[model samples]
Target chain A: MGRTTFHTDPVEALAGVADGDTVLVGGFGMAGMPVRLVDALIDVGAKGLTIVSNNAGNGETGLAALLKAGRVAKVICSFPRQADSYVFDGLYRAGEVELEVVPQGNLAERMRAAGAGIGAFYTPTGVGTLLAEGKEQRTIDGRDHVLEMPIRGDWALIAAQAADPMGNLVYRKTARNFGPVMATAAATTVVEVRETVDLGAMDPEAVVTPGIFVDRVVTS
Target chain B: MTAQQGLPLDVSGAAEHPEPLDRAGLAARVARDVPAYAYVNLGIGQPTTVADHLDPAQGVVLHTENGMLGMGRAAHDDEVDPDLINAGKVPVVEPPGASYFHHADSFAMMRGGHLDVCVLGAFQVSAAGDLANWHTGAPDAIPAVGGAMDLAIGAKQVFVMMSLFAKDGSPKIVPSLTYPATGLACVDRVFTDLGVFAVDHERGRVVLLEAYGTTAADLAERLTGA
Candidate 1:
């Protein structure tokens, strides 16, 4: 019945992440990225990590910075080759990094399934594409679907606009893209919020992620 | 200027080599065929241009897989909101009554057959209506499929926008695709710079519905030939 504690330092909030850990980062491109936590992970120098996100991040920011630092061994993302994802491109070409390119819808569902404690689910997203290669396929109700396993992370770093002392979070605009789903799919969820208020400050209905799923909160 | 005005204008020579429609022209032609009040998704590259040519009165809703519905046209440099972007990661404005949801929900709208039409760019489209656009699988190419596969299969009607020929003069519409398939029997129509084609999946043939600067017979020959 104890409440979740907030961390004043980003490094301390991300202390649980270690080398070879799988980290789920919440964002769509640059939006909703937990900048401070990402910076903290870079500072901590966790190596050979598996990073999951939507994009590789535009320019040298967020996940790109992590990849540029050579801390990531692999990246699982939908849009891994954006106009500005030169970091991933360079590493991938040099055989220094690996990439698992999942379809956007499948990516979101896999993460959701992880949080929901589901083993796996069938999706029609990548049926005939390269993404469907080697994956199990089944015909359901006269249609084809590919079986995708749940995607879980050792730690999840997410961003939010506001949070209460109990760790309930509310995100801003499109910034909320992967935050809620990533929060559930991780063993430990650390949220970076702009502001922290009292327990009841966030309206119960407005909270997208309940406090029970979060383990730490950091003000960025 | 006076000498040019008095010339015969080389009209016969001009007719010998008709120019294909430009990118915007191709998009506008595709826009003309989009049904009114339809909910549509536009894939990146040439297909995104359809948003610019759509009639404002048509009430077509643009859905972005990154969690936005009722998205507006591309935003100007000054109006760019970094956080507000389409699935392609390009900045865009949102029209009134626009709603944002979780990424999963936005995808559900796409995969659950709620979209009326999806316009996409293809590397190659088979005569049997199969689509292949995600990757060429070249040695140097970075494979990033994104949402093209989902939109290809889930949308009620899949419309493709692409050039009729590759830069090497290879026909993009062929009897069978050389590239990997994105979806099977998914495409209903294709709008290329040369013409608009209706794919007859059952017969494994593509019928030229309209031509811009080329004749149907010439286009068909090109498509049917090696």
Candidate 2:
């Protein structure tokens, strides 16, 4: 079989993921959340996962359900508390899971760094806040900057609007948030698309994630 | 605090105590100041309503921190799309020239000084323009900073919208922030129901630009101890 497979079932697409893998799950709130892939990963029952995402979980679905199942050991995200993020909030307060809070921009940039092979970079975000504690600080022309390291992922689970058979992906509207960057940061990026388009159907210039970044895609 | 007493109080246009600006009134005031051909980001809660007051001809583009620019009005009934939403998670539509990018690129636009202005709701802003809005530092509270830190320091001009006082009548504008800080010396202006104050971080002062129900001298004296 070719390296990139378009699976009919997301479970099969996620079959190789093992326990304790650092997974980067895309989405802000429910938008662009790979629910099928998350559900499959849930059924796969891999535990101690380190999930990097925007929100920890919402309501009783997607990442929340994954958190509810006790599969995640640590959550490295920008924002974890929300009106319906009870699952993660509960688990976090109970001291059952570790939490690492990062500024939203830093969260995205760190992953972009991992993908682009940047060793480390100084960022103005979170320079003096509690989040910047213990990090090296530099004054560049009198402006404060903090050293931030790259965040790599073993698996990136993302959602897309459409995908071509060769694996180039495009997402709908604001749902494209971290999907493009996450795809490049992971060793294996798994995507779930609503539909698969023929190769020529997708505009070459419009492809948000090139085929090289994608490892698997399941039509959900 | 040193410049408070000597500051000139403009009493030329005074009603002694004109009625304070309501939500719609405050939004209108902030909208008037949005420069033409500017890219703006409105924070969640009170700041979001400022979008409604914006005029299209002014070439003011709305930037939703979630990953959109040139954001349009809210989606109703048939127009709602789960994938198309604003920073507040409310369904929205894209304008004709709307653009979308990934989170990194989106945030880069903010931190890189590409945005013209960003309106936000604050818990407190000191005379030195120190911002304290992200967290209360309450032990039991679940902290969620979201994009507050990024937007606070990123925008070219940071305007804060809030009631003049807390629910208990305590002033939200203080000499120093007791609440945890979001960013240091980042806020440029404070738009309140009572008045508008400009923060001069260099001189460490809060100057009254306009007053609603209060006069400059009275608010200034209060600012010293408030």
- Candidate with top lDDT is 2
Candidate 1 CA-lDDT value: 0.84
Q: In angstroms, give how far residue A199 of model 1 lies from its true place.
A: 3.5
RMSD in Å for all candidates: 7.1, 2.7
Residues A4-47, candidate 2, lDDT per residue (tens digit)?
Answer: 78899888898878899999999988899898998899999899
In candidate 1, which residue pairs get closer than 3 Å at backbone N, Cα or C atoms, i.e. clash?
Answer: none
Q: Which window of 10 residues has the lowest lDDT sum in candidate 1 chain B? A: B4-13
Docking quality level of the chain pair in candidate 1: medium
Judging by TM-score against the true structure, name the best candidate: 2
True contacts kept of 1: 0.69
For residues B171-216, write the lDDT of model 2, one tens digit per residue.
Answer: 7777777788888889998899988877877787676778887676
lDDT of 1 by residue, A105-127 (tens): 88888999999989999987778
